[model samples]
Target: MAGTGGVSPSQTPTLPTQPGAMTPGRIGCAEIVRDLAWEHTPLGPRDRWDPAVTATVELVLTSPMPMAFCFGDRFVLIYNDAYADLIGTLHPAAMGRPAADSFGELWRSPGIGGVVEDVFRSGQPFLEPETQLTVVRAEGTRPEQAFFTRGHSLVRDSHGTIAGVLTVAAETTQVTRRLQNLSELTSRLAAALTVDDVARVVLGYAMASFDVDLCMFAVDDGNGFRAVRRIRGEMLDEADERLPPVWKRLSDDPHAPLVASARANRPSFVPDGEPLRAVASDRHERRIRALAVLPLRTASLKGSLSIGYRAAHTWLPAERALLNAAAQLVAQAAERARRFEAQHGTAQLLQRSMLPEHLPELERFRIAARYDVGVDGNAAGGDFYDAFRLADGRLAMVLGDVAGHDVRAAAVMGQVRAALRALALTEPDPPGVLAGLDRLVTSLGAESRNEEIFVTVVYGVLDPADGTITLASAGHPPPVLRRAGLGGEPPTAELVKVPPGAPLGLGGRWQTGLVRLEPGDSILMFSDGVVERRGRALNDGLDALVAVAAGASSGDPRNLCSLATTAVPGPTDDDVAVLAVERAVALSRSATMLVAAEPTGPSRVRQWMTTWLREWTVPEPVISSAILCTSELTTNALLHAGTPAQVHIDLNAVRLLVSVADTGTRGSVIRAHTDTMSSRGRGLGLIEELSDSWGTDPSVRGSTVWFELLLRSTSD
Candidate 1:
């Protein structure tokens, strides 16, 4: 047989080993062994090699990732220090036992022990890319968790023949968790655009990634801390819709423990026992037991993300590292959400501010205007109306609706409204003004790229001398007409309907019409939401509006608008703008006044109003109402109408017109809350309750607001 001790080349059974192979002094092999065997000495310099090899065996046996060797049908496990920490108590007397005796649960796993046995028998190195296992130790209370195990076999020889196997593996729990969290984070980030959505994503990520029962994020709003996002069931039963129990304020609370500690770049982890005690009081103990708070700071602002568990659970350094990384990512996402919200909110506010602040006073008309945004949550729509006195002393009125609901539409609406205001001053006639607006829109490159933004507009120039309204339309609905003489009888009004011409930017000619206005005659102009609706005929909406306007009460514009709005008895999905212009009816022969020099005092003013009403034959039940109305109006004018403001009355035959003149320029807020227990603000609103027709007039010097009440006689 050709030298049995060392076979010939053709009959070789194993590869030849180089000199000094398996020796203790080899570079790569000896270095690995030394690391597996020794620990750095804390007191002084220590030798790298362990002479007896016992310390080396122990170090390998207690490693975090599993390491093992095989000797002919026997398996030996050599783990790092973490393995000892897990099973040291149970195996105190069995430190160096075989895998079959010490950890049967791990040794019996499929392909693990059998593969090591085969490697020892065949003298072959074996490797596995990935393996899964459930390690059930004898000491732990719960079942073992799932872990991915990867290992490779090391072939060893004794006396020129293969005799043993060596292996190593690492648990993959952290890796799996990271992948799941990343998937969830991507999904949430893609869908989240609002502040609330962002908060929910951060809190949800913590709950899922850290395996916590309660997770929440709080924002610092300068004044106090409030919970903006929270995981499901994270809060106590009583805190369903309420804010955090204790909202710590930085101004008054110098020792604001949570914020201060977070600012210091330190986290506080509590296993149990009043985890949030520094921020909340004893009342929060029932809900919060154990918590870890990590401060989230991005772009100079600081907030906190908190994770809580029902019971205290100890955490390892690796777990803390994972949480820190996640918090940083959350901070970045929150910053992005904030930027998106800022842009969106600014657009909305700008659109609202661009609307007419206050209606102008037409010489003989009582004008009331109302604007309502859509219920749908989309970008701003191009619905606008304006009533103002032109520089040449004529009344100019315009109402229009843009073509779409988006940023582009809102910006176009804004530009058009501004441009129309400027052009109306130079163009006297209605058609002339609209034509000028059309030319400007085409010339300013607003309609570039063949992209069109058509506008349906109705502009009018009212001659205050004769109450004649000269109107123009660019594919807009005809105006509605109502008169005081036709009240309660369904006013016989007609739509000054014109031919269907193209809207603005359609390269068509503009059309104009004229209608004479009488004292007590009203004209109503509105967007499509008022006269056109889905699933309903356009004529039906028009007829219904006509009937409601005929039945509306003359004294209050707010109530009249409300009545017309509710006429359809259905939902409106578009923005609505209703501008009503009516001539206030002059009073018949029934009014008188009693003037008092000392009208400044509240009691005296009350008495004077009461005596004057009594002399004018006012009803007994209505006297208290008149006094209350006058008192509120007088008081509000004194407090908010600016200095040097004065009150005056123009009493005629059939009506008493009370005028309050002041220099205040800001518009008044009007509310129609009907509850008796509510506190109604200001005197101007009270005038609406007592007067027949009321409105405000603003001038460069000041403003004059007037209200009227029907009188019984002029002889009192």
Candidate 2:
């Protein structure tokens, strides 16, 4: 008999279980395991061990990978001679002990032990990409901690019963954390849109990642390096002029470390002593023990990033590479910030041009909007929102998003916005208008078919006379409607409820719905940017938005819009546009318009007035009077004031009122009055002679020219 350690040597099945010693390339651990005496172990001597145990041991010892197996129910620890050094001082002693005795806290830890036990019982495997293990380094030493990507697998006996667990692992603490820090560098820099934003990201990361005592960013302001930003530790001075510039400033001072690094275009570090003393502040001369400076030089940006340590520290090669990579990536983002800071005007123009010049404030409807751009340049974001009066006197509103955030994408957004406006002007309803927009966007993308530009849009029209909203969507988020009867817990916000439609450029049909509002009820339309986040369901963000908006029943229209748009709890990466329309019973009988600064040179106001009349289906004589008044007022403002004009028209059962406003005040009622032959200012003179009531009033921007006509009873 094999004395309970195994079957008798004569009865034991012959498997190639002693290959660890026979294998020529086997190393130290294998030789040690093969030669060590196992008097304390149940398995006894190696050659006399059971065939199953011997085979499992051989499989572990002969492999180059770090592997260990617990044999039998007692789980005796057995591992290859390899990894003795990596296993720390517990190696040789660990070979014969039980797993708990050898691994200390790691094997005894509830979280880790459960994993191993589960694999043993289920005959399944457990994998951990990175897990922490704490083990005693030596008999008297405290525990040493490390991270490993590890796995536990069941080692089956010859009869297919679970015998023990095989643990295969690789230590990855330093490497994994380093890569994570590197990835964080780019991700943090990606969000910076201004120099201040860049400084926050850079200075913050330096202190956290480098364990530095002082960190500084000296921007090169065209002339030379200026210490515009810095985070000084307790021992450092506020403004130490002794610190070196990024360029050749005070060149005679040869000890300038930053200038030297900038000139060399490489990283410079001083491990300790006098080299640091030259750069040290007078108050804390001895506090500076170590320093490193990395130069930042991209085509559009120049600066120096530096870190100082109060204690002595050597720059490891890996640490040095990581710092260099961070500086390089951050410098590129800084360059973008600088360029955007310089070219902000163009961006402002693009943004202004992308949205409606003004949102009309009429009776029965109140309007407000928020357009927040996520990127720096080309402020015309991928998202857009607009409201304008349609030909038939109803209010048409649009919300949309292009597929990307780039200058080209914003330009394309402008084109698509214009196309949608033109289509909405003539189309009968939102669905038909969306269908037209789909074909238009599809044709626009044909030239860049490989790139495949796409857009999502929601269009709606509101009739102030009845407080009704007809909305349509094409691959866009549905509009949210909230009903709150003058405060308290608002009702659950309801979606317009439409089938999902494909994005524009895909040639698909769309869906539409009609929403009727109560006194305090409001409708909100937004781009997905307002309600989408990573790692969460799309409906989760939508629900959060509705919850916030439902409670925003009592506030300024602007404030209500702001509250809903900023409902998301964290920073966002995409452009957001939110347009809110609330039923305003107070202004139901009025309409307003924003005249252009330059009236397209040749009387645009006349055409606009004629269209408004026809759209309202006003009596032919009222239409005629509105047209004549529009031509007279617009021509007077264009010829005399050379500035834009604003117009407001109001109707009641008794009369019709038209008011025109401009930047200039009434100048002695001068007009085309004197020049009957010339088509110049007949403005105030014509108003006085052709209407029932007329007056002039001063305004904040300039003056308002007003006129009113009595409507004869149609019944007569």
Each model's lDDT comes to 0.55, 0.63
lDDT of candidate model 2 versus the reference: 0.63
In the order shown, the candidates' Cα RMSDs to the true structure are 20.4, 21.2
**Candidate 2 residue-wise lDDT, 482-582, digit = tens:** 87554545355767786788888787877677788876578888889888877778888888888887665242244356666667767677888888887
- In model 2, the worst 10-residue window by lDDT is 237-246
TM-scores of all candidate predictions against the true structure: 0.47, 0.45
Show where candidate 1 strays beyond 4 Å. Answer: 1-218, 222-341, 375-378, 444-447, 486-499, 531-535, 555-573, 587-716
Best by lDDT: 2
lDDT of 2 at 76: 79
CA displacement after TM-score superposition, residue 527 of candidate 2 (Å)? 2.7
Error of 1 at 76 (Å): 44
